[model samples]
Target: MSRHLRLALVQASAQSFEDFAQGLRSLMKSPNAAELVIYPELHLCSLGAETMSEREYYTAYAEPLDGPRGMALAGLARELGIWLIPGTVLERGADGAVHNTAVVYNPQGELVADYRKIFTWRPYEPMCPGRRFVVFDMPGTGRVGLSICYDAWYPEVTRHLAWMGAELVVNLVQTSTSGRAQEIPLNQANAIVNQIWVASVNGAAPTAQGHSLLVDPEGGIRVAAGMEDTTLLGVIDFDRVAATRKFGTSGDSWPWDQFRADDSPLELPLYNGHIDPATWRPAISPETRNDLRPAGPVVFCRPAGENGPQ
Candidate 1:
């Protein structure tokens, strides 16, 4: 049987945490409010300075997983009778390292998943990386996966969730004002290749791009919001995911049922079936290919024992 989820993406433009909270309360009262509500990334960081460097900003605002901010969000979930993904906040771990963490709350207001983001856009982000990937089943919704902002650039994250049976991948983002071109396309491509619905919510201007979007399994833009302060709502159909994977006769499929017995678990059937095992060798080279030329001017480093560059 196919499943459907009604979702709302709140594209925020609030300049302060208090303003964000106030606006959120009003949005919930909309006649179109959905069963699942999601907000853009780092909405809580509004209380801090916009001029602060990434390091300064994150460190100052970091809070514990069950801190006041989290409690407030969880309470809202229960009060509204909705499953909530209130985007991410800075989590100050027991070891004192700050992580970009997203928390999931079921309708009962129980924390279902506390996912610290696995990939931080480093050299620029200055946040600690997470070690775990989180996927959980919602009561009426199919399995749900969580990722935040930069994590959407890495297909492996989404693929891991899909493999774990997630029909929907939710990415809460604070898009770079200068990088929206790349950000939008990468997420759309990820949804197409993985054949899963993606709810990509983004922070609003005058600091970040606010093109919060909902993508269907076929990579269609079901709903998209401009760089404005508004909520975008859409319905996600799990039936589309099932339809995408259906292939061949006897109910065999592309992804959901592709990892059949007698197939090499590590390799997809498309590639494994085309190769002759007896004659195969690893296709990868042990070292970088000498034929490839560096795109920029190169500087040569000599071996310790050698007098000149090799």
Candidate 2:
């Protein structure tokens, strides 16, 4: 059996934490078929730590996967009976290190997954990468995985998600203006290679650009909204994901399933598969292969590829 998921990507202003909460609560009240709702990265603040000290943002907005923001989102997801990816927040780990993290909540309001930004998009210095990657069952569909604003740039994340049986790759983003040409193709290529759906919700209005998009199986932009606030509802078919098998036999086959598991439990399967010349083309890698600053997800993730400062 396959599931068709209705995803709602929230793109609105972040006047304050209270404003964000109120907006989310009100939006969730609307009647829709959305099984899961994703908020933009750092949607809790307009300019996170820009004016306030990093210490202040950590104290005020940073919370554990068990803290206030996580708890509140948990209750909301349970109350509304919808899965929720509340996006990323700066969390202060016990070791005094800060991490940009995301939480996944089931409809029962139970926290099912927690993904720290494996590829942090920091301005001052590099933040430590999270330990690993993980994928979990998304109710009726195959699986769902988390990648934050910058983490989505890596093909490894989406490929790992698909290899782990994720039918949909959900990205919560807070993209600034003028980085579209780079990241758009990265997202589409990730979807096409891994054979799944990718829905990214971005911030809009007040300061940044809002570009919430839904990409389908054929690597086509099924629905898209520009740098303006608007919610789109799209169909994510599990069957499409299941049909992406490359080998001649579909049942007992996966193109990259045989990838050796690594000790980095968070490691996503890296693909070296040859592209089908008849139907596919290679993605531009000049930008993605280098340590480019926040150009897009792929380019953004190159820093991680080097595993050091740029």
Candidate 3:
């Protein structure tokens, strides 16, 4: 059995919900319809953000995960009969705090997984930060991890997702600054270090500095788009991720296979923590980590200290 996924990265400028929906419908009707369609971060929420104050913007758009916008996005996915990731939204949590969240809708119109942006862009981005990491399996395709714009700056974000058995990590971005140049390399570096596929989608001109790209398991750029409104399409083979890990990157470096279960822990003063070799292995094998399987619901990862005392 071959595990393959057809991906569509929509690198377009921010738009109103009406325009966004229309564009999505047109994309689905195209000859090259993709299995999974992804847009850049806040693509739908940026419509009137420029006119409103920061607080006003968040307050006006923030809604629950199952809110109207979410339901509409679900309907779009179901109607199109494809997996859809319409970028990040402003979520109004039960605790009343607003968060920048990314949602996933399966082909059945089910909202399978939602991940909030863990690394909010500080003072500029006023939304509350999310504490958990998220990954969801795509039945026959493969496992996918979610990350937002600023999260790519932190290597641990991708590292944790890779450890959780994610074959591909999608980082949704809406960058308009010159910093996009730096982000491009970060995308490739994340794929290289984790030996996994990476798809970083950025918004197009006017809304962002679009340089959306897809990096292969070996850190090679498979497809990249310029700063324009365009859709990048590619066929991703999940088996390549497994092969890369097994055979080594470029057939030389094998970071994941180098450690032994009995190896001593390597301490790190940064987080006052140590990498325990016993549990440092990738959680890809079903026989080893059944909880990671796609049979159940979405997986929410709480890092070391979140659950309780370490």
Query: Evaluated with TM-score, which candidate comes out highest?
Result: 3
- In what order do the candidates fall by TM-score, top score first? 3, 1, 2
Clash-forming residue pairs, model 3 = none
Alpha-carbon shift of residue 225 in model 2 (angstroms): 0.6
* RMSD to truth, every model: 13.9, 11.0, 4.8
Give the clash count for each candidate: 0, 4, 0
lDDT for 132 (candidate 1): 71
What is the C-alpha lDDT profile of model 1 across 5-113, one tens digit per residue? 7888988753465666666677778865888888877777655456787668766688897888778878878887888887788899999898888888888988888
Best by lDDT: 3
* Cα lDDT of model 2 by residue, 1-310, tens digit: 3356778877765547667666667777776448787878777644555687756666776556677767777887888788887777767688878777777888999988877778776574245678777666664354666777667787778765554445577787777756654677778877776767888878886455776788876678998877777777777776665445433123454444433233223322454454332212112122211221122222111211122111
lDDT (Cα atoms) of all candidates against the true structure: 0.70, 0.64, 0.86
State the lDDT of candidate 3 residue by residue for 1-310, as single tens digits.
6788999999999888899999899998996589999999998888878899977897778899899999999999999999999999999999999999999999999998889999999888989999988888788667889999999999999998888878899999999999999999999999999989999999999779999999999999999999999999988988888777666799899887666656888998999998877666666623223322333222343431132112
- After superposing candidate 1 on the true structure, give the runs of residues whose Cα lies further than 4 Å from its correct spot: 53-59, 247-310
Give lDDT: candidate 1, residue 249. 21
